[model samples]
Structure formats: structure tokens, C-alpha cells
Target: MRFEIQFSGHENIRSNHQKTIEITKESHLTPQGDCIVGVNASASCADLPRELKDKLKNSDSKITFSISVENYEFIIKGNGHQDLILTHEEDIVIRKSDFICPRTLAVKCDKASDLLPREMVELLRNPNTKGVFSITID
Candidate 1:
């Protein structure tokens, strides 16, 4: 199954955090939010589809998410867990660690914001740039 989130880029998108990748519902960005790749997000953790959230709570579920913008694409793979609450209201986060939080979408992710290509990070710095974060579960 699949779910997609639409979001826009921001000039302050640093994409330099070593452990996490994030998108937020806030329209504004600050350089200190180094993990946030997009803002004005279409969905927060609590806003995810019920079916998708259910699957994401299963320990056996495998999740893949593609962060696509313009001509660039970054893929992240992670496993779901029974511990996931998936109910944060303002943000969606992908973590390279096994941390579980309401804002986390996938844990043990293969990539964090710092791993994103510099070219892609540059594009993500444009406030007008649009992105699609699509997730598939199996």
C-alpha cells in the first residue's frame, strides 16, 4: 500500500542533520532546523491514513519512502514497529536510529538529511520548490 504527502521547500532548509530527515506543517523554516527538508507539509504524523498507520505499527512491515523533487529522488528504507504511535500533529520524521516517537514515520532509516545529495539540498532551499514524499509498505 501507499501514501503520499505534498510539501514545499524552504530557503532555510539545511538538510545537514546526521540522524533524521523531516518535513513540517509550519510554513517557515529556520537554519537551525537542519533536518527539515520541506515545510508546509500536507500531513503530520497524526494525519496519516489509518490503514497505512496500522501497517506501520506492525513489526514485520517494511516501508520505503521516496522523497522526490523536480528531477531528484532520494529513497529511504526502514522497518515498522509495534511501538510506533504515529500521532504527532506537526511533523513527520524519518530516523536512522531505532527511536520511536509520535513524529517518527520510519525507524532505522537508511538515510538521514545529511545523506541527501548536495544538488538536491540546493533545490530544497528554494522556497517555491515543490516535493512529493511517497511511501509504500509491504
Candidate 2:
């Protein structure tokens, strides 16, 4: 079976410095579906809930990740740093819909505020919609 891999956060998607990786595709044939791929801390830090870990752990391996995929955008706000918008050109960014709290900076997935872990819910809310784009990693 094949799977789609996506990472979203800073910008340099293809780089090794990514913070979070999400696998948007799921296998109905498998026990879990529609999950991200990576370690527990990574997923949790990425804002994926503990409840969803099983599915994410079982995801397919052929990842098609993007560093800040075109469909989504995000902002970074943390202590001692100016709030900024992360882009695809930076190695730290992941794919669309993923989150990353840089060591010195916190992040807000402009499009995915509602789905954030409850503790992070207060940091950011609601992403203003931008132009639409489409990508199918499967």
C-alpha cells in the first residue's frame, strides 16, 4: 500500500530541520486512517492529539511532504521574537495544516486553530482564508 506524507511548519520542507510532519492520507483497509507520521513527541508537539497517535503511527511510508504546502499558511509568535509568517522557502516549515513551536517561538496554524491541543487553543484562533489551491498526495 502507498501513503501520502506531509510536513508543515517553517519553510524548508525538503530539509532535515523540519519540526512537524503530517500524513493526510489514510488507509481504510488498515485499522487507523487519516493520520500523521512520526514520533509521539513530534506529533504531540506538532499539535496532533494523543487520541490520534495510533492512526498516525500506522500510516504509510511513501511520504509526499511539502514545506508549507500552498493551501495553508501560518504565523509564529513566541517569547523574545517578533511574530512572523512562515514560508516554504525556509527549512523549518512543514506541510499545510501542521504546527511547530520553535524552541524560542510558538506557532499558530492560521487554518487549524480549532483542532489544536486544548492547552494551545488559547494562543491562536481562526485563520483568515486565503486563495485556494489543491494537492492530492496519494
Candidate 3:
């Protein structure tokens, strides 16, 4: 399925409009019995919390996110790190090549009932977290 993910935040953080990703049951399933959906794009360093930006520059840090879809909710936690590729643009693009920086949480649930690929993207777009940018679906 295909879905568009948008990021919104304050002026300091450059928010990305709509980014798209495709998910499939066969491709997303992991050996640990989890479904993994990820998108890699860059966001402006300024968009990140001052502490988080500093931490990424110096070392890796754990970032947590809460995702909810209809009646299902799950938490995805992953390490955030600095991207080596510096961009001339102002926004930070979470690239598929990089596994860190705003990656979605690996969801653990009954895939058949809890979430579809499109629903997974919807959950990420509307996460229940503060300070971090809000996401919208389109």
C-alpha cells in the first residue's frame, strides 16, 4: 500500500510536507516476529531539540515514538544518529540508506488484524509525542 507522511512543527524546525512510502507484508516482516516500516528523509538540524541535535553530533541516542491506528497502538524505539551526508538544503531527509534519525518504531502485533501497510504509515503520521513534529496523512 502507498501512503503520504507529512511532518509539521514550529519555525525553528523545518517540517517536511508529504513523503510517500510503500509497504508489503512479505517485505516488512522481520525474523523477530515484527513488521518494520521505515522512511529515510532529512530534516533540518534546527528542527531537532537542542539536546538531541548535540547528542547526534557527538554520539547516538535513543528516540522513542508512540503510534496509534484506529484501536491499535504500539511503540517504536530506535537509535538516532547524525547523517554523514551534509545537505545544502535546509531540511533533513531521512534516507532509506540510513537506519537512524526519525526512523519508525518496529511494530509488534498481529499484522493481519492490527495494521495494514497504509495504516502503519497513518499511525506514524499521528504519533502521540510532544516536541517532536506532528504528522498528517494525505
Candidate 4:
């Protein structure tokens, strides 16, 4: 499977509707189990002093990570690190007895996507795909 990371546009409230964004390769990730890969995108949010808090409140400059498995394509939101878009592709070994077509599959990430400011549940349900994508909160 191949994975690619891309950044897309969104509202930067702090910039007063300005489309200011920066893309860089400084992502880092720690892996778990035999399937999961975790990524850390930014170094600090500490510089957001009170004076700039409101302006940067809801701005998210997210990079898109896409994975192609078999004939299915799955996408997750994150940022890039070193030009490598991070992702975890697992080989889910299914036994004949438990091989029913599952409608959803729960996935756990090192960090948490539960409180992340976007909705992507529907994307995991593409007909071409075989499983559901879930963000387990830690």
C-alpha cells in the first residue's frame, strides 16, 4: 500500500479570513503493536499567548494522509514530517469463522482524535473499503 500526505485549506480565524498556512516536514511518530503508527506534527502551541489566542482559536492546517488498500482508499487528517505522510496499514488476518463482512472496524491511535475538530466517520464507510475507521480516545 502507498500513503501520501497533503495539506488542504481551512478558515484561519486569527488571520481575519486570511489564507495563511505553512507546510513543513517535522512530523514524528511512535509505533505500537504490529499495526499502529503514531505521528506528532508540531513542536509547540505554547507561543500562543493570551493576546493571540482568539485569533488562532480554531485554525487547523491539517495534512491529509491517504492509504490505498486493495481497491479501497482511506484518508486520515494529520500533518507531514520529513516529507513522509505517516499512516498505519494493518494486515487483519481473518479466520473463516469470523470472516463476515464487517461494516465497521474500530482503530486505536497513540494520541487521540476524539476531540479533534473535524468529522470523518463517513469517509471510512466507502463501499470500496472493507472496514470502518475509528479514532480511539486515550
Instruction: State which candidate has the highest lDDT.
Output: 1
Model 4: per-residue Cα lDDT over 11-45, one tens digit each: 21111111111112223212212122111212112
Ten contiguous residues with the weakest lDDT in model 3: 8-17
lDDT of 2 by residue, 1-138 (tens): 212224322111121212332322111112131122211111222343333222323323122222223333333221111332222121222333333333211222222222334222222111221111112123
TM-score for all models, in order of appearance: 0.97, 0.19, 0.31, 0.20
The full ranking of all candidates by lDDT, starting with the best, is 1, 3, 2, 4
lDDT of 2: 0.24
Give one digit per residue, the lDDT tens place, for model 1 in 1-138.
989999999989999999999999999887899999999999999999899999999989999999999999999998898999899999999899999888988898888999999999999989889999998997
- TM accuracy, model 1: 0.97
Q: Estimate the overall C-alpha local distance difference test score of candidate 3.
A: 0.31
Q: Quick one: RMSD of model 2?
A: 16.8
Q: lDDT score of model 4?
A: 0.23
What is residue 51's positional error in candidate 3, in angstroms? 1.8
**What's the lDDT for all of these models?**
0.92, 0.24, 0.31, 0.23
Kindly indicate the candidate among 3 and 4 with the higher TM-score: 3
Pick the TM-score winner: 1
Candidate 2 Cα misplacement greater than 4 A, ranges = 1-46, 59-63, 69-138
Residue 7 of model 3, lDDT score: 34
